[model samples]
Target: MEFSFSNSQKMIQKEVRRFAQEELAPQYSRWDREKQYPRELLRKMGSLGFIGTSVSQENGGLGESYITEGIICEEIARGDCSLPMATHVAGHLCAGLLEHGSQEVRDAFLAPLLAGEMIPAFCLTEPGSGTDAVAMQTSAEKKGAAYILNGEKSGITAIMDADVSLVFAKTDPAAGAKGVSCFVVPRNLPGVTMQGYEDLGCNAVVRGSLFLENVEIPASYLIGEEGTGFKMAMRGFDISRILLCLEAISPALVSLEETMAHVKKRVAFGRPLATFEGVSFPIVEHLSLLEAVRLLCYKALWLRDQGRSSSKEAGMVKWMAPRFATNAIRDCMLLHGHYGYTKEYPLEQRLRDVLAIEIADGTSQVSKLVVQREVMGREFLPYNYR
Candidate 1:
């Protein structure tokens, strides 16, 4: 019913937009070119409490609503899309896991993570398994008061710089999905090793592989009970998928804005480029499409803020936002003519970064199946069985 942000939400939005544009936008491409992780800037964001919005105020977080979280994510992304990999959805997942962690775990890890003094990585996907997370080969064997973790987690964001990792491994392999347990494993453990990747976009994120060879940790490091990790991860995904969509939307909207300004001023054949229906209409269409999805993104966040299930809406926008945002950015690039293709402009990089959204969090195919299962009932799911 309410269509506008609250006074507090608006205040947060204004500040975030200013910080993002002033501090983040200038170096957006610099990090990409230098392949740097922007750790110092991340610390700055943390010092300003911009990194993780979900932590409780008592826990040194703002305890803001999911709607507020989306606002920050979208605005920060407007300035630089790649940084949210460390601050938004994935950051939330790390926070969510730590929220359920034991007090000692929270004291040692969560505090620094929220403060931006430390980087956190969520380890769920491995080189050999992702969608079928139950089939993961990572294992944690309990011995005495400790658990020895051994596995390789690939395609992880900020792995190279992460001070800690929420590692997923099967404590009881025979229990299938139920056997999986989450652990708060320090990335600097004796047995841990890492290698960075040469990714196509979001190069600043430094996505890489994590190899744990007999990594040992106290048994208290296990998050929740054994076999509950899968559900915890899935629950976090419901909101994270929505956040990822908003991240994609931010850059697309910014790209469109850049294109809009260029077309309005650039003249062709004695007429402004914006005067052409071909030029103006596509801009209008992209704006309209993105606005609709943007509203849906917030709606999903609102439902989450209400403590209601938003998986259906999350799945719907998860696929649509990235697919549409990428299209809009690509068109924006084309509309900019030769200038768009060059790295001098942000369009090409925006296009490349947005393209990664189509695959991150969840693939378009998997997202559709999530919606299918939700809307049509589990009985109709392709993998559903009585």
Candidate 2:
């Protein structure tokens, strides 16, 4: 696969790097410490078309490809994962809607999202449903021309700041996967409320619990045909897992580079620490693994651009990148010695940030199972009956 970036891609990367250094990197530590999402910074990102990288130009976006989007994500995330995550959430959801939602639904939400005027959250997980998403208890009933949504969605990334949510619930509770449906619910509707959640990292994301108590939305808000939401959600994940891999790539590169510089200058026992094979060999190993995952991620993105099936590639990278990246950060921290344990250095924060990738989209074990199913076929899959 050709990994070379075109002149345009290089310019895009440069623009993202400048933005990250000037706007995001400086205040990221502060935001994480204070557990605040910077509204001003988000607005600035919107003004630059960073918030809608993959959405159509007609929808007020730059209409970047998955490769360009990945590059943008990696650059922004190199400074900090939280800020890039916020932009990723908006762009991925808006772009998904453009592909899956009705024209009327797209018209109402996509433009504002691209303009950075609206924040969108994807609400699929519930208090009871974690990995077993089909077990979601959230229920929506058709009432005349409206669907009365009554249930709770938990672990939403940016529900507090979201003006709209792409929510999934059971339209026919007894129908199993066939019962699932997706909706675009407005935040201001009656009986809809967001309660904040506290987490270990990515605090800038504004996660919360969404309670829908007989909230009514028009049938027009349905993203696609009924009973198809689960498939659409997985499709969204297949596309997003590539970007998430890119996000993890940034911090991995940062940790590796930072450690490289530190070890070269950090003297111990009459020589520089970089002279030790223990420290240097692991760094080399991590660099090699990171480059492999980077190529895998971009290949998946390129395949998607070509309208090819990328489930195997996506699942492989989804598992590999975060696992390797987290390990790289941990090893880098050890190389940093006593200073690594403190918040004064970014290693601890980088570890916390990249570790989340394992749990997001699909966990490491879950992703492997997906790969197993794809290769071994359903007959050999462990969870095939479930």
Candidate 3:
């Protein structure tokens, strides 16, 4: 199997890395401190065709491969973990919805989202529901040519600045997962309101609650066939989790590089800290894990590009990468001594950002269940036996 990136992919990596370093890295701290969304920078990225890497050219996107999308996410997170949220919203969430959405839905939303003129949010998790998405209380009642939606979606990322949202609500609650349907809801709709949260990290893309109080949207806003929202959302996560893994791990990789340089030059006692086994071994271990996880991420993406099922590999990395990266970043922070604990260094922030990934798309516990279900057959799932 080929292990290296193609020339074009390498170019994408170099360009994204340069852009992230020059544009995102400098302003990340300020944005995080102010809890601001970097809309203008995201527009810049869209202009450069970085925001919609997997979208087709006809849809105002770069039409690059999934591997290219992962590369962009990795480089963006390497510079500033919070910034890649824009890519996640634009590339994974919006693009995935557009793929399954009706022509009318795509016509109204896709272009502007690809252009970064509008930001999109995905609403699935609710106040009482997360891992068990089918338990959502949100309901969309059909009324002639429209649907009236009423419920609160909690812990929704990018909700604070989203111009539109892909919301899932139950149309037939008795049908369980099959009862759910997806809708493209505009932020300016009469009954739609939002409240931002004070999250621990990745503050640039604020998490928030979406309160849909009898929000009305035309029937044409529905995505795909009725009762397929759960499957569509899961498919979107299958694509997104891989990118999220990259987002979580890349920052730690950055921290490792920075720490490596510091330890090699900064002397402790009679020699540099790099000379010590305790200092050096952890770095080696983290580096190895990072490389392995990164490769798995690419493999999953490559499998997707080939139209193969990668849910198993995706689940593996989704659980492994974030947890490992969090530990790695924590290790790097401790190695930095007192400096790492302070806000002056990015290590502390990186740790916080990576920590969020552990719970973002899916928790490690849930991801392991997904991997188990895939490996050991669906009959072996806890819920199945229970």
Candidate 4:
């Protein structure tokens, strides 16, 4: 019931806020415009432990609380609003695989990833499969001491720049979800190829398709037990969705703050825009929604830290926050008039950046299905049979 951040958490928020404004805010627009990934800045963040907020200290990370990780994502998104936060979330997913990966896998991949010397991508979605992860077509056939991987992954974030990928493929195609397994595949492996996509937003992260043709990797690269990939991925999504919600909402909050200052000073029809109920009311409503969803995100993270199930809370925020953010930013842009629509201001970019989050972790409809299953019991699920 207590709702207050500890001194350490507050300190983390302040430090990250300061760093984000000073470093990321200045270059984000250019990066987005040029569709360039800020690898150098990411390395700096990794060196400072910002990239590994939720990772264990033993793995060369900060070993911070999940709430701290949420705060970090919020503050960073408040600045760049896209690529850095996406990359951070992707890194966290990779960290989860490392947690379950073998020591050799950790030493070979996790160490460099934590150090920011390398970037990793998470590949779960396929050309034919997204929400129905059990329907994935990617397969890895056991061959002696190795697995020959041959399949394609679509909508994989940061695939173009990633040195390693955490891939999910079927080891027993007929076993359905039980057939799936997770593997850490290096980009240098034979028959590994990638092609980038031109996205509507989040251009800097540059999502792409991954092609694995007769790719061979040692069986030791497999993470955890075979046939548990779907379960592990769902658990990771429970954590990532909360962080993704924070990232989506923080930029809208920042835009609102900026608009508030402008509305108070900019005159319209012989009065400041803030004096008009039309302008002020919508801003106030958005402010309230942002605050509410932000708290929901923190609550989810808190539950995670307490080792409690928060699937319902996570799904609620994941679906609601991004939709709220996109609408909120759009209103803020309109309030600014022509100035907001132009590239001269960051609001337009903010609009573009947040819109992508609606589809990133889970679609709004998919998240609602998650909440429905939790509340109405698994038997009531849409996919359940009579």
Candidate 5:
């Protein structure tokens, strides 16, 4: 049960931290205020091999481990949460495709994605389904040598700017989880439409809905075999939940450090705010929780790198990391009093950004259900329990 990073991993972490602090931190405030995504920065990330750290070197990637990917997400997120949205999770999606995609499919999508020439999105969540992905109504029916896809996917991150999407749709309505299949859907294909949407946070990145009405594509676009998309999608989430947890944790750490710095300088009643127990105690609690959540996230990533089944650990961290992070950031905001409510400082923005973790990847309640099922087995939730 080793918990520390290896020397190589430490080097990766240091490089990522330098990139984040030097390239991302300075412009984050301006970008957040303008709600702008730095595409050029993303290009730089790709050029530097940060975007495709997991894809094999044979496939034009750095062949970095999943733990390295987690480190990248954590460092980028620590400097600016939006960086992970623009480049981090997109990298994860590419890695998932590279892991499960066929040779032909890999030659087509993986190369471009690794080189940062194309952006990819994982389309699993729909209007009617989120945590329970089996409820996705998007249908992809086999039609001779092609598949006709029809349905709508909302709340998809980076869809608006992506060149292609790893779209998941039901192929066998009667098979439940086994009925799901993944397809590589190009945005420019016929009958494909998009509708943009807004979210309360991460405004720098684009969020939109994809509408596939009789969108036809060759059968070769299927990522894996039929009836295997559900498992593949779940695998992607297991990897991504760790990244999301890191993103959530980083912002809280940053806010905590910033608040601690501020309290040491800001005086109230002729003394620094840190002199008061009210301010310092919450800081202490936040620090303790942050350290604990950080360890959980690293452990999940390490287990993944070791090819271990991390469903239970991933589920537990998914619930704990974001919850702890948001609570800490919220408390930090309160410590700032009226200044936190204003947009002058980054506390309010950090609060808004970190709050989205509660819903992303998996909701709090849904994650609990995962933990429960792992501990109590499938019998805990009956087939008819809605």
Candidate 6:
């Protein structure tokens, strides 16, 4: 298998890295401290084709391949890990829907979102159902020429700031997953209310719950065919899961890089910390593990580019990347001694941010289950007996 990035891909990576470090990395802690999403900075990024990776060239996006998009995700994440949750993960989801949406939906919502003039929220997990998403109780009933959406959406990212949400609700409650349908619901619609959460990390996202009571949207707002929303969402996850893993992995690598620089200059017992195997071995091990996962993330993206199903690889990396990223970040902090624990250091914040990835997109357990179903066949699944 080919293991090298093309020259153009390499160029994109370098330029994105430069942009991320110079523009995003400097304010990584500032956003966390202020608990702001940096909307204006995101606008700057959006104009440069960073946030519109999923949008087609005809729609003013770069029209890049899935692998290239993954590269952008990893690079952006290296600077500000939390930002990708809004831009790459949810943003990608919204684009996927809009790309298949009616021209009216695309013209109204997709354009502004691609321009970063608006924030988009992906509403899937309800308070009652997360992993078993088909169990969601939210409903969107057809009435005349519109669908009236009603239900509570919990664990939404940037809910307070989002201009629109790609909401999934069951249109036919008896049909299980097939009952689910996706819609673009504007946040300002009547009967829509929101409550923000005091999350442990990624505060810039303003994570919250959205309550929709009789919220009405036009029939033209439906994303695709009435019942195929769940399949579209699941397909998007096949890549978002991997993109998110890369986002998680990038920060851990950044933390390790920072730790290495610190150890070389930090003298302990009258010698630089890097001089001792005790201080150096852990860094080496983390680098090794993270590098392995990073390569796998790219491989998953490559498979998608080749029009193959990468569910197994996406699941494998989703569980491994965040777990290992958080582990590496935690160690990087410990290696820094008390300085890393202090607010002045980014490591404390990095740990909190990376920890959230273990749950986002899907939990680590769910990710492993995806891998198991793929590798061992669905008949062997634990849930299959039921």
258-293 in candidate 2: lDDT tens per residue? 999999999999999999999899999999999998
List CA RMSD, all candidates.
1.2, 1.6, 1.3, 1.3, 1.8, 1.3
| Candidate 5 structure quality by residue, lDDT tens digits, 94-130 | 5576567778888888877766777887788899988
TM-score of each: 0.98, 0.96, 0.98, 0.98, 0.95, 0.97
Off by over 4 Å in 6: 384-386
Better of 3 and 5 by lDDT: 3
Ten residues in a row with the worst lDDT in model 3?
A: 377-386
Model 4: per-residue Cα lDDT over 260-332, one tens digit each: 9989999989999999999999999999998999999999999999999999999999899999999999999
TM-score of 6: 0.97
Give the true-structure RMSD of model 5: 1.8
Residue pairs in collision within model 3? none
Q: Candidate 2, residue 240: CA error in Å?
A: 0.4
* TM-score of predicted structure 4: 0.98
Cα lDDT, model 4, residue 55: 82
Which candidate, 5 or 6, has the higher TM-score? 6
lDDT preference between candidates 2 and 5, better one: 2
lDDT tens digits by residue: candidate 6, 1-386: 78988898899899999999999989998898888989997788788778868568886578888888998999999889999989975458778878889888888888888888889999999999999999999999999999999999999989988989999999998888888999999988999899999999998988999999999899999999999899999998998998899999999998999999999999979999999999999999999999999999988988988889999999999999999999999999999999999989889888999999999999999999999999999988888421
User: Candidate 3 or 6, higher lDDT?
Assistant: 6
* Model 2: ten consecutive residues of lowest lDDT: 93-102
Which lDDT tens digits does candidate 3 get at residues 166-233?
99999998989899999999999999999999989989999899999989999888888889998889
CA deviation > 4 Å runs, candidate 1: 384-386
**How many Å off is the CA of 137 in candidate 1?**
0.6
| Candidate 5 ranges with C-alpha deviation above 4 Å | 382-386
